[model samples]
Target: MATKSLKAKGNELAESNKQLDILNGGIFAEGELPFFKDKINEIGHFPLRPKKLEILQINVGYMCNQVCEHCHVDAGPDRKEIMTRETMAQCIEIIRNTGAHTLDLTGGAPEMNPDFRWFVEEAAKAGIKDFIVRSNLTIIRANKKYYDLPDFFKKHNVHVISSMPHYTRGKTDKQRGDGVFDKSIKALQELNARGYGMPDSSLRLDLVYNPSGAYLPGDQMALEADFKKALKEDFDIQFHNLFAITNLPIARFLDYLIASENYEDYMYSLVEAYNPAAVENVMCTNTISISWDGWIYDCDFNQMLDLKVASKVKHIKDYNEDLLNDRNIIISQHCYGCTAGAGSSCQGTVA
Candidate 1:
């Protein structure tokens, strides 16, 4: 992924009014933290831009059953940013015409969306190479209506990427909620029963591991190995892979850092662990994030920050892949969260 070196100019990237407001406030401006753009600039990657646009990650809504403390979207039951079928219709059009190979559906719990199944059924017809549904796991056990989610996912050949904060109950429940571990375990077992994570099965079941506190994740392969061994040993659970995602400081997570007085320390860690190599394959370079309403962003974090795409095509209704791809990727202090250490992405470490 060779990149064109951006000219060092004030108008390069951080000049966007909204991005400046976001980056200049908070600890980034108050403290002497290294700006993420400056770090990337050291490697001549200023004014980051998109590449092939491989993934279209859509946040169906923020109506989640469980309110994880580290949720960047601040998603919860009381939130009312649910996507209507009208916007979904616009998304369906993009799904059919997108050059992106992966169509990722995320939410508080995507299944909670009233028309979730209809959307999935329609999306499946597009024959996308990879259709990802980021489930909270417990949603399968949240209610009887969601009981058939595993079978529903299997029918659409949807890739199941569920979050399992940890293999242990204490850690998992602490980050999520009480009884979450039991329900998630049951959901995983149900998925396994349907051959979702069986070795060599086309049905893929992967678990995402987010550190329960204010810290970065360790080695991906090491974590995956540990999670696999523990889950299999304890409950005979089988999963294909584990994604160790670093918790970015934003939204509920930012609130946690501030409340715990770990904001500055966490920012320092992110800056210290910065990896320029990871910038080459940062998810933002190849993916576009569409919010619940239809606003597009460089990535989901950017969406949460209300940083719309720095392009003419800023919404799904007016999505123009060519024009969108031509725009510079938005950058700010939070970007360091994605570039720290091995580099975190929705698919785990990029480096």
Candidate 2:
């Protein structure tokens, strides 16, 4: 009887998710209201404190193939926002001056940008120690022009990190879209064939995972093991480390919480699980997020919310490392998601 009841609940949840997909029109659909309101209230407003900007993360555009349910960026196919070459030039100038070790490029699909390859080559020429691109694998297979991205990435020795919500096709498709899983799988195989994620390949390939619901993610290490085992067994896929990120309570996710009547409960979950220690390793402390328009933020999550770094230097041209380093990290209810459990960040758990 208990097992039957559990199954019933699961079925109900799945049905609800299907309805949501239809209502919102995609997997990572946009939601109304801010998901981190309570957490923000609890934590109060705080400024961002930069710790020697080792990384310069740039948002090349806001266009994407899939709109996942939990996407804070709210990026989608219809988004018209794309970073201009002029902006890229400014970013390059900063790279030359700051000597930041890593240049992390992101977008609806960074590869979709006309100047993406150009930027990669330029950054590489600057002798940046690490060049990271956050890709949504399907884009690599969406067009013939993008077919050679894996090769180009390998040639430049760019570290590739991609979003793969689940190992199973059903869940992946449900979160991304129909046919997305197949393409992502093919893309991963291509990358793997090019020495990525291989035993000793220097061309690194990492996968990212976020929960499919309002709840925080489970153990990162354990989830990674499951993904590794399932992908390898099911599709003969191989990859390096898996990054388990918690879904921030903002954008479409926040909309889902309110629509599903789970907003309060979700907030309670994060608050109850908050670990002070997690704050010490919050990604914002170590990383700086740059918007396509040149606005700077404590981290990517803040950028999505239009929460700029609490410093006089909000844009790249006016970047003041000392002032940013001395400011306090901006805190809000959304932070609980990062501080919960083992903690979560773009790189995975903070703890």
Off by over 4 Å in 1: 1-23
- What TM-score do all the candidates reach, one by one? 0.93, 0.86
- Which tens-of-lDDT digit does each residue in 1-351 have in candidate 2? 011211123533233233333323322133332333333444542343445667788999877777776767767776667888888888888787774788899987888788888888887887788889999999889989889999999999999999998998888887777888999999999999899888778888999998878788888889889999999999898998999888877766776676788876776677677776676677887888888888988888778767788788889878767766677666666777888878888888878
What overall lDDT, based on C-alpha atoms, would model 1 receive against the true structure? 0.86
Model 2 weakest 10-residue run by lDDT: 1-10
Q: At residue 121, give the lDDT of candidate 1.
A: 95
lDDT of 1 by residue, 1-351 (tens): 001111121223213344346456776676677678778888989989788989999999988888787887767776678888989888999999999999999987889999899899998997689999999999999999999999999999999999998999999888898899999999999999999998999999998999988899999999999998999999999999899999987766766677689977988898999998999999999999999999999999888777898999988878889999999988878888899999999999999
Superposed model 2: Cα runs more than 4 Å off: 1-48
Shift of residue 235 alpha carbon in model 2, Å: 1.2
Q: lDDT (0-100) at residue 196 of candidate 2?
A: 89
